[model samples]
Target: MPENTPLLSVRDLSKTYQAASGPVEAIGSITFDVRPGELVCIVGPSGCGKTTLLKCLAGLLAPTSGSVTLDGAEVREPPKKMALVFQEYGRSLYPWLTVRDNVALPLKARGVPKAERQALVERAVEEVGLGHAMTTYPWQLSGGMQQRVAIARAVAYQPEILVMDEPFAAVDAQTRADLEDLVRRVWKDLGVTVLFVTHDIDESVYLGERVLVLSSSPTFVQEDLTVDLPAERDQLTTRALPRFTELRTHVYEQIQRAKRGEAVAATP
Candidate 1:
């Protein structure tokens, strides 16, 4: 319960799959902790099992060894206090449902009362700047707007931790920048802990308080680097800072090293 204690703890977590040939280890071992209200971004090479690691943390997949704990309890199944937003925004949203209904679905499943659910839905829609699109269906919106709907759904759930796996990858450059700022605004406003996984180095630097770099294939923690930039960041001004360039360049080098198999030992 202490502020310093980790809200989510991952200890020597690993995952291996049984195949026809042999056991293929996706995650060698990864260890990290996310404190309350911290926004942490994870980056690694394409095949470094970042998604696999996130699955274990989300309790959607069991690890081969070690553990993922939320608030001191081992995560066995998807935690009720946690929410996930995936990369494929179009697939996640129900084409049949209106934006309001899609955002309210989770609350409804959780048995939230109709009045409270409506209030939460409206507030979340407005928060994401989608107040006018409440009655529109997912199929009717642009790609970026649909992603906003996905984010609104997560925000409306009032999760303690929001796990986003490449949530902005599908949008265009301008939209991606807008969504990045939106995330920061929402994070600051709600004080929700965030664990974001992205392959983009710049995105990691822009969004995270700490960026955890993962090693190649049999993945491990290559580096856990902190972002020392000011809290209030704009895409143009923040990215142009000399410190930003240095941090991003450093992360880029670490990832390149990871690809070349220069893995540092992860903390046990």
Candidate 2:
């Protein structure tokens, strides 16, 4: 794929579910593109159908109209070249499996050879700074460490695009910061395309090269604002920047407007 072309494209996508009460619209229409090796964060008002949009992108659910295409292929089911990391680390990891086995599960399922799988697992685990706990079980690790294991699992899959659904939401503030840095490091090191969904305005601003803000349900993209922060960022120094404050404040104001039923047109 050309570097300038979108690695993932979503166009005119919408979802309406058949509910007991009546047809319920979640995403009214959404359009966005994630280019190769870009780290894009998605933020929205509460109940703005972020998860619903993610599900459609991952091909876990079909859209009512429009389309999600990964690379050049339409995504009708979970794509093998894509990997997902959910927020609930405790639920995603296996209590019975050691860290190595948990991280190796996806590779093994894809029919990766034992020797090659072990190498990928080891490298991914080390990348996430969990090399010392390769034998530790999920039940024995801290919540943050467990989330690291989940991230390692996704990394080992060697996905072309990684879609993370609020993966840091369950950790403490300090741990969340650490995990956020870890994501940046891995993204830089591996050059994987990342589409992260989070409800955190500050986090979205801090982590993304561009932040796509969604409006209240039935939702449409409220704004697709470029985050002009430096490419290299640290929690303390980056957050202290005056530009960072302006960006977050802008995103917050957009969310407020969205909640008030004000919406801009979907990006074409």
Candidate 3:
């Protein structure tokens, strides 16, 4: 593929489930593109099909209509080039395995040699600032640390795209800030395309190169707002910038408008 091509593309994607009442549409036809090494944050009102869209992108759930393509290939199943980090790290990480082994599992599944797996695990752990916790179990660490282990696991897989679903939603304010910085740093250092789904307006503005807002249920793309923040983001300095505040306020108002039953036109 050409270097300028998008790393991922969602074309007219929509998901509808057959419920007892009637056809329950999770998202209306949605379309968007994530370019190579770009950080895109998706924000939407409650029950706006954010999770459904994510599942479609990750190939966890097939879309009722349309399709998702990664690296110019249709996503029929979970692609090895992508990795996902869910909100519930407590359930995601295996309690029985030490941090190093947990991060190494995906590598092992891919048939990586022992030495290569160990080296990757070491690098991933250090990237997340968990080098000292490599010997610790998931249950032995704090919630934030456990999430870092989960991130390390994803990193060790060496995926080209990282999909994070509310990864910082459960952490305390301070911890969330630290994790956000960690993700930004790692994404830049590794040049991985990232699609982050979060409900937090501030977070979306602080971390994304652009923010995509989804309308209420039967969701479609409401707006695609570019975040004009600096690439070198600091938790304190970035968040304090007037531009950050402006972007965040726009996203917040859009969500509120979406919840009020405003019809959102799909973006081309």
Candidate 4:
């Protein structure tokens, strides 16, 4: 693929589930792409098919009507080049395994040698500031710490793209803020393409280079807003800026309209 080509592309993607009431459309035809090193956030109301979209993008579920391609290849199943961090970190991590082992599992599955895997795991743990807890089990750590372990595991794999599905939703406000910044820092340092889904408007604007807003159930892209905030964004300064407030208001109004089944204008 060309350097400028998107790392991942979704072409007219749609998903439907067979229900007793007949076919229920979860996501309507929608299209988007994630460029290498770009951070894209998707936001929508509850039951707006955000999770369905993530599942399709991660190749965990096949789309009923469109395609997701990575590096010019169709994603038929879970792609080794992509890693997902879900909201439920407790369930995502193994309680029986030490933090180090949990972080190393993906590497081991990929046939990475023990020596390299150990080095990668250690580096990742330290990056997430969990170096001192390598021997700790998931059940022993606080919710924030366990989530950090999950992130470390994803980073250690060094996937071409990282897909986060409301990864911080289960955490407290303070921890969620901290994790948001951590994700931004990691994205900047590692330069991996990111696709983050969230219901939090502030979070979507805070962490994303561009925010993609989706309509209500049977969802489609409602608006795509490019966040023009400075690269060195902090919660206090960035959130208080006029531009930040403007963007947040814009997205908030768009989502409201989406819930009403009205077309929303793209961000100017």
lDDT of 1 by residue, 142-243 (tens): 999999999999999999999999998888999999999999999999999999999999999999999999999898898999999999999999999999
Candidate lDDT (C-alpha), each: 0.94, 0.94, 0.90, 0.92
Query: Any residue pairs clashing in model 3, and if so which?
Result: none
Candidate 2 lDDT tens digits, 171-258: 9999999999999998999999999999999999999999999999988887889998999999999999999999999999999999
Off by over 4 Å in 4: 1-3, 264-268
Worst 10 residues of 3 by lDDT: 259-268
RMSD after CA superposition, every candidate:
0.9, 1.0, 1.1, 1.8
lDDT of 3 by residue, 121-210 (tens): 999999999899889899999999999999999998999999999999999999999999988988999998889999988989998998
Better of 2 and 4 by TM-score: 2
lDDT of 4 by residue, 156-213 (tens): 9999999999999999999989999999989988988889999999999999999999
Pairs that clash in candidate 4:
none
| Per-prediction TM-score | 0.98, 0.98, 0.97, 0.97
Sequence-dependent TM-score of model 1? 0.98
